[model samples]
Target: MTDFDLPEEFDEENIVSKTSIKRDMHKLQALGKRLTELKPNQLEKVPMSETLRKAIDESQRITQREATRRHMQYIGKLMRAEDAEAIQNAVDLFDASSKAFAQALHSLERWRDRLIEGGNETLSEYIHDNPNADIQHLRQLVRNAKKDLKNEKNTGASKKLFRYLRTIDDMDNETTP
Candidate 1:
C-alpha cells in the first residue's frame, strides 16, 4: 500500500497525524495573534525569541491585508520552534492580572457607591474592613460626595472618593502575600 494510505488497523502509538500538525500550527497562529494584541509593556513580560518579537512588531506596523496575513503565518512558523507552552503561560498570567485589576476597580466603585448612599454606616464598615484607612479623609470625601449628589453638581467629590478607594485597594494589595 502507498504511504499516504491508512492501514486497516491504525497504529495507536503514532498519534501525530497530518491533521494534528495542522491543528497545532493553527493554535500557534492564534497565540501569535494574541501576542500581537498585547501592549508594549505587556509584550515585554512574555518570553519569546528576538526573531519572533520583531516579527510581531512588524505585523503590528503592517497595514496591508495580504502582508499582515503573511507576517502572521511567519510568526506561526517561528512559534513552532520556540517554547510555546511558556509563552502561553505568560500570556495567561497577564490576562489573570488584568482581570484582577478590573475586579478590584469594580469593588472600589461598589464601596464608593455604598459610602455615598449609606453614609456613616458604610464608612464605619469600610474602616472596619481596612483598619489602616484614613477615617477623617474618607469621611470628608464621602460627605462632599453626598452633598454634590444632592445638589446635582459636578462629580469632583465622587472622583476624589474613587481615587481614595483605589489607594486603599493598592495598599491592601501591597500588604497581602
Candidate 2:
C-alpha cells in the first residue's frame, strides 16, 4: 500500500528488460549519427509574392501562344488526312519559309534592343540643332526596316523557289509512273 510497494502479481524483470533497453538505445544513437553527418549548405529562401505569381502566369501564357503557332505550322505542312497531295510540296516549302521568317524575327530583337538604348536625349539633341534632322529618326529607322522586311517577303525570289520546288516534286511523282 506504500509508494515503493507493488502488487503481489507485479514482476520487475519483465517491466525493464535489458534487451529492450539496448534496442532503444541503439536506435537513438543511429538517428543522432545520421543527423550529424548531414550538413546542408546555406539556405537561400525567397518567398513567392503575388507579383511573382502574376509574372509567371504571364510568361506561361506567352509560351502557350507560341506553342499554338508552331502547332498550326506543323498541321499546315504534314497532316495528310486533311489530304491534298498536290499541295504537299507547297506546304513543305511554306514551312521552310515560315521558319526563316521566325529566325529573322529573332535577329530583329537585337535591333529593338539597339533602338531602346540609342533613343536617347544626347543623340536627339545633336540632331535637333540641325533643321534637316529630327528626333523621330529612331522611329523612322524602325519603320523603314519593317517595310524592307515586308517587301522581301513579297519578292519574286520566294515565288520562284516555290515554283522550282513544285517542278521537282512533279518530276518525282512522274518518274514512278
Error of 1 at 15 (Å): 3.8
Candidate 1 Cα deviation (angstroms), residue 89:
1.2
Candidate 1, 157: how far from true, in Å?
A: 16
Which regions of candidate 2 fall more than 4 Å away from where they truly are? 1-14, 41-177
Q: Candidate 1: where are CA atoms >4 Å away?
A: 1-12, 96-177
Clashing pairs in 2: none
> What local lDDT score does residue 165 receive in model 2, on the 0 to 100 scale?
32
Worst 10 residues of 2 by lDDT: 38-47
Worst 10 residues of 1 by lDDT: 93-102
**How many clashes in each candidate?**
0, 0
The total number of steric clashes, by the backbone 3 Å criterion, in model 1 comes to 0
> Taking the tens digit of each residue's C-alpha lDDT, what string does model 1 give over 1-177?
998898889887977989999999999999999999998977877789899999998887899999989888999999999999888866774575666456667788999999999957778889999976899998999999999999999869999999998878656644642
